[model samples]
Target chain A: MKHAFLDEYSGLQSPMHRLDPRAKLVGLVALVVICVSTPPDLYAAFAAYLGLELILVLISRLPWKHVLGRMLIVLPFILVVAVFLPFFNKGGGSYNLGPFTVSAHGLLVLWNVAIKSTVSVLAVILLSSTTPFPELLKGLEKLRVPRLLTTIMSFMYRYIFVLSDELQRMRRARDSRGWSGKWLWQAKVIGHMIAALFLRSYERGERVYAAMLARGYDGGLRTIYLYDFGAVELGFVALVTLFPLAARLLAVG
Target chain B: MHIPDGFLNSGVSIATGVVAAGAVGYGLYKAREELDEKSVPMLALCAAFVFAAQMLNFPVAGGTSGHFLGGILAAVLLGPWLGSLVIALVLLVQCLGFADGGLTALGANVFNMAVIGTILSYYFFYGIKALLPKSRTAFLAATGAVAWLSVMLASGAAAVELAVSGTTPLSVTLPAMLGVHAIIGVGEAVITVLVVGTVLAVRPDLVKTYGYQPPVPRFEEAEVNQ
Candidate 1:
């Protein structure tokens, strides 16, 4: 029922929140690319990347709990994919870790996936936590992202909450009806629920289109330009961009 | 699967990014003809539907749960062009709004799930459907089979990308990813079939690719065939 979680902290008046969305998008994505592109053995560069991310996090004033909580979503993936590396990789020669034999190559691969993915996810979380969803979409549109895609995304964002609420209601209704959904054949209930949602959404889309046309629907969606790429945004972008690059160069040297 | 930012090497990421960009661009161009002004909102709403449906988790074996991917399902409902775009939109939102996937790896994820997953499943469903006699069971059976195969193929693509990025060896990643997804795909197949079957029973016209109507000459039918 509550939808504030999408951009819960975005309204806060921190410097990270005040910066232009375009600046934040560009700068943070640059940080991610540089961080990911860095060599796996570049511990110094990884430290710098993580350090820069932390500084931004602090500057943004987002709760450590929220950031860490969001980071946990990727943990299962890391464990499933990377945790097996040390056991499977035997390229760099094997070393016994207690009773288990592990390879240096596998351990390095594990570290690479763990660190890179963590830092990258954090960068995105920072970007999103600081910028509201509408502003982020607007920023994307301004940054030469295709208008069609952005418009589609904007509409999708608007309705995710509505549909999810409906889904929750259906789940409650289903559970209240005493259907456990345990047996494999019971997947039919889930399927029917999805079908119902799809039909509701489709009909709603048509109604929305008709309403838009009644009020003169056009191919392009228009919004006021509330963003200014001034000196503050420039400096923020430069700091984010140059800090990671410098850290990477220093690591190489 | 949503690959995080750091797992893919620059080369693999860029290459997939290029391929994804090209495919998305092409999809947009083709989808334009079908999506006129009227259906734009419909497409958006369907995109939202897919995103929300994905959040609906179903029970799997041993008390485990697997959520819907909605790639092949969307393709079945809305043709490959618009379906790919819808799935890509969902992926982009998940990456940026939710941080479910990595920004740098967005292209790779899009390529695997949206492009390969959606388009591949579309053709597969059609190819299979054509082989069977015209019947409700045949249509749904084809949807279920293609949905299952689509997940395995997408995961296989992801494993290959991981191997190419030197994140994992092909031998290890291939069997491991596919082996796990093989079970997850059953859920995908079941859900996809039920949804498509329900929609077909209720409003067959809403299903873009459902050929339940008698053979009639329609402008859209020609486009669908191509």
Candidate 2:
């Protein structure tokens, strides 16, 4: 029932955390766009990008272990998609590694996928780790995102843990009833559990609606609107912008 | 599966971004009719339930386990627009809050899993449901099979996006993605069927498939014309 998978280090105080969430959002988007647009063969630009990300990570005061650990979630997919690229690509001038021929261009493709994904993911990790989810949503709302989308996310953030706790209780109850069998046989029970959850959620929805109405709740969701923006945030955004630009120019030259 | 940033080229990413934005925009316009003051909470809660449900993992065969993608289940329960909207919200949170998907590649992730996955599964489930008898068993079976197919197609869509971006060759990426997803599809089928069957047992009315008009009988030509 206990989940800290989101914005775990948001409580930490640092320059990155203190910057306006919109700044982080916009800055990170620019960072990703820049990193993704760079050619893979430009190893120097990649290093500079990594350095830029590292500088931000260090400033953010998030644990390196946590940031690197999150990479595991994205790594396997990249490996699955790119691992064979080196072998399957029949580009001319390839080296023989084992039975399969690993092409130079193939290696470049692998490098492109791996490095670019890593850099962008790292930038994301830094951003999410530093910015709290609610502020992030507010930042998005500030940036002209659809109000409906933001409201939906607001509820998701609030009730995700509640529903997960309910799911946990249901699981415990099932386990307590000696509900142990191969899924092939016990699939029926799982199905019932899912149904029960849906029904419970539906009923809960009705109840929540009643409560909101009793309190004269309007349909719209509104959060207090103030993000502290000063010299530090602007300077931070400026540096993030400049680093990518400088790296690309150097990579091109 | 979440597509990471830079795995896709800029051109493909932008294209998918445009497509995804249009789909979500359309979904919003459509979903607004379904969402009201009372139903909005319910809808949001359903999205939360989906978020929670996605975390419940079941063993596939190995020590590894696969969680239900929830696209088809949501589509079957709450029409495709609401379903896609909920899944898109979930994907958005995972991308921003947990860094589960890429920021730049968020469009591709939503397009593949939410828009494509939910809409495609809904239509497929509808088609299969029409052919089968109007019974609970047929409904569950249709849901299971279509859920499996939906995941495979979504993965193929992602693979194609990657291929178009020149990230990987189509011949290599398409087969690889589909092959692994074929295994995942089995898990998706089992879980989707199990959940639909359970729900049908408890509250028959909650099954969205049942609320729609019955498929016209192929043998009864006169009834259809009337």
Candidate 3:
């Protein structure tokens, strides 16, 4: 019913939160590229990137716990990738742990992936925590993101919850009918359920199109609210644009 | 499965970004006629379903869990172009509002999950449906198979991107990604089939491609001989 999992923290206010969505979008992109492009061995650069991100996280006023918790979502995925690096990455320098050998090079690769991914993820969290979904869509559209795709995205964002509710209703109906889905043959029952869902969604699409036509929706879309690039937005963009260039220049120097 | 920013090299990410932008542009041009007023709300609802479905993570093997990608599911119900747009929106929202994905990596994520996953699966599913009976059952089976394959294919493409960027070697990443995702694909297939079937049963008119005539109907009796 209440899906606050997305945009949960977007209502909060801070300097970062006050910036334009497009500004945040561009800034975050610059930060990610800067952090990611640093070589694996550049521990100093990595530390700097982490510090920069930490500052932004604090500036955004999103709770540290929340950011860390969200970052953990990617941990399992990172582990899945990093776990095998010790075994497969053959470079040199082995350290004798208790039961097995840990390669020095493998550890560095792990650090490279783990840290970069975490920082990149944190940057994203900061951006999302500050920006609302509708404005974000509007930002993309204004950024020259194709309208077709944006329109599609806008609808999906709007209806994903509705579909979820539909699914729950279907599941409930089945359960009430004593459909436990415990046995292998019960799999067929699930199959039938799937078929039924498809049919419903299909029919809904046609009706939805008909409704659109009734509203005089022609092929072209004209938006009522035009996004203006304000001074604050410009300043935010300039600040973000400088960070990556500064980071790269510092690295080279 | 959306790879965030800094996951891949700038060259690769930018290249994929350009590709993603072009595909979306082409998709917009193609779907211009279909994106009229009536389709807007339905498209929105479909996007919401995908977003919700993604939140519910079903368990996979080895104590690992996977969520539905919903590309094929969206395509099967909304047609490929609209489906891809829906998924792209979901990803965009996740990045900007939910912070589920990276900002710079938005292009690559759209390419992997939205474009490749939806278009490829829809075409393949559509192709399969052409060979089978025009009944709902045939559509269900074909949708299931294509949905499964699409997930696997997206994973394969991701693995390639990682490998190309030298993030991880192909030998190590390929089998690990494929093996895990192959299992994940089963969940995808099941979800796709179940959702498609349910929609078909309740409101058959919602499916954009429903009642679409195949090159030749497989079963004579199944045909509505007016």
Candidate 4:
């Protein structure tokens, strides 16, 4: 019932956390662009990006353990793609390790991916850990993000748990019925289960829409509360834009 | 499959951002007729649910675990326009609040994960439903296949973005992305089938596609007789 998975650390108090959501949003975007645009061989530029991120991470006051833990989630996917680079990359000199050969070019490719992805992931973890979800959505809206997308997202975030709970209940019921899907024939049972879920979801959508109609909803959504962009927000934006530009200049220098 | 910032070039990021914004705007216009006061709360709750479900990683092979993209799941429950909008919103919040995706790269993330993933998945699933037996069983199978294909397709799109931007050579990037993601699609398909199946059993009334059917009438006489 109480799931704070998405914004677990958003409520923390820190300079980075105190900035307006819009500011953080803009600043991080700029930072990511700068980081991504750095040529793959620009080891110096990557280091600068890492340093900038580290300072921000510390400023946010998020637990190192938390950020690292969240990042670990993507490591497997990163590795799966980059793991064989050394064997397959044809550009560099090859080294024979018994049956397998490793290429210098492949090693570079692996490093390029691992480093960029890790740093980028850390930057995101820091942002999410610091900003609350509702405020974040508001920030996007204020920045002129489309209302329809936000509305849909807000609903998905809200009800995904309800659906998941429904799923758990069904799984429990199946288990109670001695439905152990270990054999090939049992796969059909799973298929039936899937069909049943689709029907239920379809029905729920209708009820939800009907409920919306009952609430005097006749299109055009307007909110009573409007977010004001304050000095803190402006400063935050300046800092975000400035940091990346500075990083780029330093890399070029 | 949300690529973080710094993964692709600035041009790609900005271009994708504009495209993402355009799609979201279009989606909002289309869903304008749909979002009333009742649907508002449901939309918010579904977004929260998507966030939660993404946290629980199911194990893939070789000690790896992957999270659900939820595009198909969302589309199956909500129609495509609404579903795509919801996913775009989630990605927007993810980039800003959670920083799960890049802020600058937000546009690209949305274009791939939200627009491409949700819209494409929805139409594909809908197409399959049309071609198949329209039986509940056929819908389930179609959902599974569509969901799987959508994930791979989304990944392929991302691969193309990276290639065009020249961030990574297409030769290395495209094959690498498609290879791993094709396997990831299996995970997406299984989770989608399992979750979709569960919802079908208990709350058949809740599903949007079933709205055409009249509600099951409660027999007052049976209760009184009992």
Please report the candidate that would top TM-score against the real structure: 1
Lowest lDDT block of 10, candidate 4 chain B: B205-214
Task: Go through the candidates in order and give each one's DockQ.
Answer: 0.63, 0.52, 0.38, 0.27
Sequence-dependent TM-score of model 2: 0.93
- Candidate 1 residues lying further than 4 Å off, grouped into runs, are B214-226
TM-score of the first chain alone, every candidate: 0.96, 0.94, 0.86, 0.84
Best model per lDDT: 1
Docking class of 2: medium
- Residues A1-253, candidate 3, lDDT per residue (tens digit)? 5555666688887888777788887877777777777787766666777787788778888887888888876676676776677766777788877887888887777777788888788877877788776677777788886665666666665555666677778777877988544333235554454455444554576677677678887744666544456898887777666765576567766
lDDT over C-alpha atoms for residue B160 of model 4: 88
The alpha-carbon RMSD values of the candidates against the true structure, listed in the order shown, are 5.3, 5.6, 5.2, 5.9
Better of 1 and 3 by TM-score: 1
Worst 10 residues of 2 chain A by lDDT: A180-189
Which docking band does candidate 1 fall into? Answer: medium
Q: List the candidate 2 regions with Cα displacement exceeding 4 Å.
A: A176-185, B212-226
Every model's TM-score on chain B: 0.91, 0.89, 0.86, 0.89
lDDT of 1 by residue, A108-143 (tens): 989998999899889888988999998999999899
lDDT of 1 at B22: 84
Q: Where in model 3 is the C-alpha error above 4 Å?
A: A162-234, B57-66, B130-137, B202-226
Ranked candidates (TM-score, high to low): 1, 2, 3, 4
lDDT agreement with native, every candidate:
0.88, 0.82, 0.72, 0.69
Interface RMSD of each: 1.2, 1.8, 3.8, 5.0
